[model samples]
Target: MQQVKAGGLPAVSTNLDAPKTRLWGERRFRKAAGSALLLCALLLLVSLPFALIGPSVERLVVLVLINVAAVVGLNIYTGNSGILTVGHVGFFAVGAYTTALLTTPPEIKADSLRHLPAFLANSNMGLGESLLIVAVISLVFGVLTGLPLSRLRETSAIVSTFGLLVIVNFVLKGATNITNGTKGIYGVPELVNLPTAYIFVFATIAVAFAYKVSRLGLQLRAFQDNEVAATSSAINPNRRLLEAWALSAVVLGLCGALFAHVIGAFQPHDFYLTLTFELIAMLVVGGKRSISGAVIGTLLITALVEIVKPIESGGGIAGISFPPIWGLTQILLSLMILVVMYKAPAGIMGSRELSLSMFKRPRLSESTIDVASLRAVESRSERPAATLATNAIGIDFGGVRALNDVSIKVETGKIVGLIGPNGAGKTTLINNLTGVHQPTRGQVILDGQEIVGWPSSRIARAGLGRTFQNIRLFSEMTVLENVVSSALARGHLATGVESYALSLLEHFDLAKLADTKSSALPYGAQRRLEITRALALEPRFLLLDEPAAGMNPKETASLIEAILSIREKFALGILIVEHDLHLIMRLCDEVYVLNKGEMIASGSAEKVQNDPKVIEAYLGSQEVRAARRKKTT
Candidate 1:
């Protein structure tokens, strides 16, 4: 046993190699390999039936596979970022038109597109060459579109992307030389057969699955859950969204190119509103969050279309005659979407991945954090003493001042408390320090560098960690994932992140619940999980807002112990904005009081407790108190 010092506490025996052992002991590689093999097998099984049904049925299967690829591409962005984009079909259109122009013969181009540039008019390429060119073009479009799209959120993003689709359609329709002016491109080579379709679909599935399980995917999902919490953990939401957007654009473009080769011809309308609705319906119906959902939804919706198409054309099925319905397929699809939304809003699979774990017995072993692992994590790095201070900071929202001339300081290895009645601006001050709000005046300094205008992610990376007043855990993610997300944002490698996150979880006694969904945890556990998540950043300063708000005495005691241990072991500054005065007095070395956005008193807990001004702020002024007493009498 190796002895290690914990803050100013007695030395304890620790195992320094425990974390290293756990680091290398992760089973992700083996699991990923196994899952990949399983996915390949599943794809083969699905294709076997369609392959045996002859050429005509095989064609339908290929089309279905193409649609599956498109939906998966859309999911890569919308699913992870929780941002709805209707403009992906624009990339699809670009790919299809670009492919047609490249693969069409020079004579055909010369006849139909008289005004085409010399290079385009003379150029004719093979399927492989055309697809390569199409990918590059799509990537350029992705970056150009993503630059603005990534910065918008919700309705704005959705509306802007729809505008992108409209613009692309208008361009394709008006550009006579490039797209033949909506008379539609023809003479595209038929290069995508059943086997080629299978290959592309399999590749798409593999890419989506791999990305969904990657660190970037986890960070994006965290941002999807809560933007503020994600940024505070140092995850750049816009960067992640932009990355997803670019990748999704490339995938959608490739799918469109493959569709062109399959169909042999297409008009601009083929990749317009109708196609956009169909692809989005597939993703939404299947569950936008999972790769499996995209495949399942595509298959289901494709089958429905196939079954209804004949009836929609006034043809009989199984000797039953039906009237021709011009838009029957769309109507049925709309109805199905309505039913699915009402019954299962998250789609069929929700956020779950299809896995082989169901075939195996549950493991009975517990994952405990030993003392040695704790010491190893604590000793992983050294942190120097630092101060976080807000100097004469003032914040105004609209015409109202939220925080005026609020100045405070916290030094490493010290616990400072901020307490006041409701609307005292404690949280607002924390927000200012953590970069959630910019002060209208004054400066926030960390180790002598002012960082008032920086984004929350940058401030977090500058060694400030914070827990939200509302306890904004990534509700859909697992407890382990929440911690790992913060570590990943802090630049931890995927291979070693599990061990690092697990060490922090163990410190907070949350290791046993690591596999549980964060929203499923008890209220107290959720609070602790938020703190553990913040700790994963290895921050020099931690700002905790209302950590003890809903905790019971036991939980509060445990939290106090954890806080003290963290301050000792990590040598970090802690600023706690808590309403629990007893807990504040017990843990905080110094206290600051605020009244109506202004700092009124600051001193040791005992000194502030007896201050007349502090009492008046909490209760009332002398005259007001006297008036109240007279009224009561």
Candidate 2:
């Protein structure tokens, strides 16, 4: 690969670097279109045999396809965001009721005791128009339901969704006039035939697959894996989750409308817990992480359910006498789900997407350092240097002072270190600066504007980024993906982002492992990757907590070099916490010493290192202690 120099460092030449292979846009559209056509062909092929057999078999195929659409919708949220959602059925119910109310003949609606709003009660539309209305209604319900739940912790989030389902169920049963109550709505026209079902299923698959590889999908998965890191990278967890939930809900609603038509009748009980359980089981058994998993799980469980229904009805199978068995399908499905959970917790697909890329290695050019190009990219940020300062910041945790009147300043193009023994509250100070902890008695000023109580995410978006003491790379993602996700944190996902991410990777000597999963990288590489990910935020001030903690001497040296190089390239103000004094002394322009939650010393590295008080803190010199006692007396 050719190399070009931009900022005194050699970077990979633009011509020599391989073009980005994003699974979206033209290439992705082509693949999805092809997949859709292939799916259509397969559905047709599958339908022919059933069609020849009889209309009953063909109808079963159509129902199975509709189920696939619903499952795919559930998978979009559950698989991508790692949130187990049971409320999608609520959206489905909304879609079905909306479609049924609008499309039902006026005579039937009048006889059913119509009490819907005047517009809805009087309206009767074609199947296409009804479905369009369903889409709109579903999206609204999805957003409304998802907003509060998306902000909750995992278990609470799932539990809150149960409440949504219950509310929808109650509403459907209670609203006798509009829904015809528990008795069900009849005379719903069967608009979705096998061909239409095939089209809908194909469309669902296309959307799901596209979403799984979209930028939003990447951010959601990253948020799922590491919330703190994702936040620091400017990924908004609640917002991403809500988006996924809404999209999933809309798709599920469409499925529900189609299902309503297929059955020619429905009740409040149709879209409830049992259907929710079936969808969840399919997702878990087939693997919630991939479209293929959703499709496979849906087909397998659906087939089993169909087979068991006949046995439950006392139909003898292959000379085996069958007797009536209430809830046999539910029992068998439950057992199968339990078995899959025990045998394979990740389900059959695990976290892998079905992609042709998996069959062939990514085509990347031989790795080369592009220090200049990387630096060149940063040179675009010629805005005024940022100034971050804390004025007498202090916080008390249950009356124990974690930080007492601590104040420090980090200006652009400077490296500052906070060093002390393990309990000296070094990290606490960083936390206060980053808005992870709101200082009780001080101002955290960025460019002279106080931001002490701002949320961590807002602080990050305000041009401050941080890395944890323990490496927090989005471990489930590839090295490049981890950085690219960060780069897109500010909502820019243009094609240029890929090159910038690669340049950062190249600068850190990580481009060679661009496609390697972050979890699979060596510890040192993971640490560097974490730094690279943080840097992708384009922060004016970067806070690094114990960045050199687990590094060997060589790794420390390399890290120190990278820190210095990146600082210069980006004109960043850096606040670092490192136990390696030698590396710190080499890298930091100024250093602050803390002891027992107080700043003991602060100045140039040489001045602080030699101060008697500094010496006392590290080595406990008796002379220094005695001198301190004398001064106190």
* Deviation of model 2 at 88, angstroms: 0.8
State which candidate has the highest lDDT: 1
Clashing pairs in 2: 10-371, 11-370, 11-371, 12-370
Task: State which candidate has the highest TM-score.
Answer: 1
TM-score, each model?
A: 0.93, 0.90
Please, what are the lDDT tens digits per residue for candidate 1 over residues 506-601? 667677777777888889989989998998888889999999989899989888888898888778899999989898899999999999999999
- Per-residue lDDT tens digits for candidate 2, residues 381-483, read 3558779998898999998999998889999999999999888999889888887788989789998888977877788888898989878888777787898
How many backbone clashes does every candidate have? 1, 4
Note the residue pairs that clash in candidate 1.
Answer: 15-372
Candidate 2 structure lDDT: 0.80
**Model 1 — TM-score against the truth?**
0.93
Write down the worst ten-residue block by lDDT for model 1.
4-13
